[model samples]
Target: MSRAFTREVDDAPPPPILERAISSARNLVTPNGARQIEQAMETLDRQIEASGDSEALAALRRELRYWHARHARMEIVEPPEAPTIVTFGTHVTIKRGGEPKHLHIVGEDEADPAVGTIAWTSPLARALEGARPGDVVEFQAGGREEEILVLSVKGASQ
Candidate 1:
């Protein structure tokens, strides 16, 4: 075939994978959150070993690096033996607009708002910190401030 009529194939390698961004804030983790990170790292190790594709391996390695860094920096904050006030690793019940809402203050990795769990660093959790039963916390929601009455506080169970 004439060189002008034939198209050449490009064999360039895939671009380098970007590393996952690690949070700069203190890595506070509950017991359960620590366990979760361990589990994730274990799973990623297995996947990285099994991954055959270069691109896939790169992505998996990036994920593994993130998990490793998190595990290394994690500071386990155990729930208080007898929690009397809202704090990290505690379960808090608040009344907003006469409706009861339950929330678990946990580590950033373990937060799931749908299940009523929020990160200890979240605005609501911060506002509730050091509060006891019968205390009202002012929270900003949707650009408005509202009062949330603390109904109860207890150590979070695994």
Candidate 2:
């Protein structure tokens, strides 16, 4: 048999790997967001220290990479000195769809709607950024469009 005909053949080429995606938006973080990232890193470090499985360690490393990037770009925006007007780290109360909603404008990582915190870049927060008490702002949420009234503007503390 000819060498060319007798040569062993590889069955198939491996599938292409798609690289993980990362956000390009500015990593704007509140004090709490920064703290959360730090806490995550600490936890990841502990896991990495105790882990012996190669696959699990690889996954942890991937997460560490993301957290590292977030930490590097972290911008801790403190509450505005006066907080008279709505801004980052400001707490605002609004009436949306006739229901009262109290939320704080925080960083994306620190957002927890169940806890009454929304990311600053969120549509509702953007709409309410400059609004003061009694000012009505339009909001589009859950495919429904409506106006939200700013009921009150409080400092970040409250």
Candidate 3:
């Protein structure tokens, strides 16, 4: 049977860098991995069908199918437009105590603070969003008040 498809948020745009990351992840899945997952699903389906005994197993199958469909839908969704504010997919440069730092604002799935990419939900990102160049933003981090001045904002790109 063909799977039924629906989106939870029809109008929501995907996070740009996140979409790219997801695409990369999907691409990285080897043929063997795909075959393995398919094999597992088929086995599970067969067991569930034969048993006619486990609602939990059937529910698990439904959840797995839902996630698979959601992932596929996300792959096709257009990314959010680059925002003037410090939103996901924005590259922001800032200065703190005369030291310059750069951060790529991305979704939680793509956050990598070691490389300076931070999630938009982070305290620093929250404080920096909507701030223009030269605007100082203060937030508590590591139990101390940290201040950063926005130096620039642009879309994440080469």
lDDT string for model 2 (1-158, tens) is: 55676534444554444334666767788887999999999999999999999777878888887889889988888887556678888888998767999998888878999999998888888988888898988888889888888998887555
Q: Which whole-number lDDT from 0 to 100 does residue 27 have in model 1?
A: 91
RMSD score of candidate 3 (Å): 15.2
lDDT of 1 by residue, 31-105 (tens): 999999999999999998898988888889899899999999999998886799998989889999889999999
> lDDT (0-100) at residue 6 of candidate 2?
59
**Which numbered prediction scores highest in lDDT against the true structure?**
1
Q: Which stretches of candidate 1 lie over 4 Å from their true place?
A: 1-12
Candidates sorted by TM-score, best first? 1, 2, 3
Give stretches of model 3 more than 4 Å off. Answer: 1-83
The residue ranges of model 2 lying beyond 4 angstroms of the native Cα positions read: 1-20
Candidate 1, after superposition: displacement of residue 47 in Å?
Answer: 0.8
Candidates' C-alpha lDDT? 0.90, 0.83, 0.61
For candidate 2, the C-alpha RMSD (Å) to the true structure equals: 3.9
Report the C-alpha lDDT of model 3 over 47-113, residue by residue, as the tens digit.
Answer: 6666654565656566456435433433221223555666556678999778999997654444679
